[model samples]
Target: MISGFKLDWTLISPVYCKLRWYGLQFGVLTSFACTCLAAIDQYMCTNARLEWGQWSTADVAHRLIIIMTITCLLHGVPYLIYFNLVRAPIAGEISCTSDNLAFRQYHTYGYLIILADAPLIMTCIFGLLAHNNVHQLAHRTVPLVNVL
Candidate 1:
């Protein structure tokens, strides 16, 4: 959230002339993706039973970190290329903006996919799976009756 605030501020701040759009994009996407990965991890952990072949939380976390890093790097390339601080003709003020129209549209679509679509879908899927797993586990457990 703080990264998001910084990105928002950088876009609007008049005094902030230079913007590292790649870093900003990478940070934002990585943060959000990692958050979703964490939710998936929680669901997996909750559903895991005492099995020998099951993956450990540490293993899962490490894999997720690697995946998130690679994804962020891949997605951040366009921001690195197209985003720059330019002076507006009418206002004579500098602001962060994209250079190429086509690339900008592609980048916008990428953001929508990564930030909105993927997260929402993943969250719902994991949440429902976790709920069902918990319900099933609860039903399978035998309730002890106390007889005095």
Candidate 2:
């Protein structure tokens, strides 16, 4: 018993496993939040009157679509890669106080984060589609009343 009590591998392993899972969940949540923020900022820039310009409604929608696409590329993609590299492998190996286990859990968290960002990418795709439809409508006829 290295730690004063008889070391129980079965008892400890489950705790480590849970910690690793929780770490993964945390990472996923963090990544999702970052993605959402980027998308929301772009949405606001495009649909809200937060920017300094007297853009026509069509111009606003066009700018928003462009901004959202750029933000997705610039922020979401790298975050996904970074998270995967740092967090994926130790998905169920972390422990409460074990250093090696903790490291693995942390890495597993990084992976989950990247995986979670998939939804944000999808959101960006849909946003682009919606923006394109609006743009086309603007050209062909009266613009939609609400473009967001």
Candidate 3:
């Protein structure tokens, strides 16, 4: 909202620029990770194997979420270090960009793969696995008869 008013905090402060990009990546990655974790949790819970079902407990879910949160935060640290406000000579336009050339390239390509496609693929895989597991529940120790 502040940015909508043309009072961009990132433009005013370098620290804000760093933190803005860092927080953006952190939030995006964390959301995707959590969603992937949920899909895996569903697969675990639906598995016919008792050992796999045991891992679907609330405690395990909490731990996994925490681990993912920390991992995403760590992954975003590079954005904090690399992203900065760069001045363009053509029109004196300032843009938020990465300082390192390699990191910039990675941000473009790697972000698409790591932050976009990977999670969707993981979610689809585990979702299908869970569906298959549900179908096999009828063969487990506790019988699950198909509904008419």
Candidate 4:
């Protein structure tokens, strides 16, 4: 009976660990993406050029919504495919794990690319651009009084 209990514990531990690990991964990725996107939107709204045309706030919001939706879907599909619970060898026990090693690797790489690398690069690029624009604007002198 004691050995059976130990076997049950061994079988259950992996499932719990996988659940916590993947849960943290998903949570961190989602939150990071959201925060970065929001910061990007805020920076763009304040510093964007409207030389050709003007965009309404609603239009900008819609575009952002579409972008976020696409990003989530792209990141989510691989996770859905590879992350799942499987029946363990022990009867009535299950384990949470990746369904495919290749898919899991792909998902990890994709997460790093989409959630970490891309966002960092974009934020830095846009931040520099916005800073430059603001600096140039501040330095430009406007005539306060008309010279006859």
Candidate 5:
């Protein structure tokens, strides 16, 4: 029984090791992509106000404030939840890390919520693309059949 238990751990160890490797890869790539999106949003807002040079400093400031607020709520919070909550827990389990365990538990629920919203986001993106396609076609003439 002791020998079998030891063999089981040996087998399980590799599984956990692979999980940790994949988790870190997933987390890093996801974080980098999100950072790129944040940068893009910042760039877009700046270009709309400063590059155009029509808006006053107050107007630009207000726009930036709104953009930053929305991004923090929509992107930043969810990102932290995904990283410190979902990815970190799985990673910690694999590595047997006790540090940050409390933070991980606190954020676990956010991961559940984030997973639930994934489908909604996909639906919204597809709907937007379909709407845009219809709008583009509206300017073009299509052949129609007439029945007397």
Candidate 6:
């Protein structure tokens, strides 16, 4: 944004155009994946089952975060491939876009619809489960711990 908007630099470079698209998708997809993972983690941590609770450890969370980061970074590779500098039909004005027809469909329906909404739905469901578990904690009997 700063490079393009603030600096008013021309995006004639193919590498810059590709990297810009990749970076945008990477940031968005990674955050969505992490948010869903966090909700799932919270739900697991609040579960009464020992095994479920065991899955919510800091080590597990860190590992999952790293895995998701790599996954999201890789996911943006298609965007980098498909996105490029294109000339408009009207006035021959150059703009960054994908010329691939199938990719355009996927970006519209698959990415914009399914990939985007899936996380929102997952986050809502798991977040509500975690929230309910937290609220019900007071009524449940606490396990007595041996203090040091």
By TM-score, rank the candidates, best first: 3, 6, 1, 4, 2, 5
TM of each candidate vs. truth: 0.70, 0.32, 0.87, 0.59, 0.30, 0.84
13: Cα error in model 5, Å: 5.3
Report the error of model 5 at residue 79, Å: 13
> Local distance difference test, per candidate?
0.71, 0.49, 0.87, 0.61, 0.44, 0.82
Better of 3 and 4 by TM-score: 3
Instruction: Please identify model 2 stretches exceeding 4 Å from their true place.
Output: 1-12, 51-122, 129-148
Model 6 lDDT, residue 23, Cα: 86
**Residue 86 in candidate 6 has what lDDT?**
87
How would you encode candidate 1's per-residue C-alpha lDDT over 1-148 as one tens digit per residue?
3376555655565233234667777788888787787667657766847552155368767987998799788877766566777678999976677768897787778667877888889888887887887787776664532322
What are the per-residue Cα lDDT tens digits for candidate 4 across 1-148? 3376544432355544454555566667666666666656646555647631244266776787678656665555555556667675668656666778887686668657866787788778767766776675565534323332
Best by lDDT: 3
| Candidate 1 Cα deviation (angstroms), residue 72 | 0.6
- lDDT per residue for candidate 2 within 1-148, as digits (tens), equals 5377877443455444444444555555555655654554444445434342244355655676666555544443322333221223457542333235554575568545556566668568747854765575567555454553
| Candidate 6: C-alpha lDDT | 0.82
Error of 1 at 26 (Å): 1.6
Alpha carbon lDDT of residue 53, candidate 6?
A: 94
lDDT of 2 at 145: 48
Worst 10 residues of 6 by lDDT: 139-148
The TM-score that candidate 4 achieves is 0.59
lDDT of 3: 0.87
Q: Positional deviation of 87 in candidate 3, in angstroms? A: 1.0
Instruction: Point out the higher-scoring one by lDDT: 2 or 3.
Output: 3
Number of clashing residue pairs, candidate 4: 0
lDDT of 3 by residue, 16-135 (tens): 999989988888888888889989999999987899899999998899888888888899889989989888779998877887999999999989898879998999999999999887
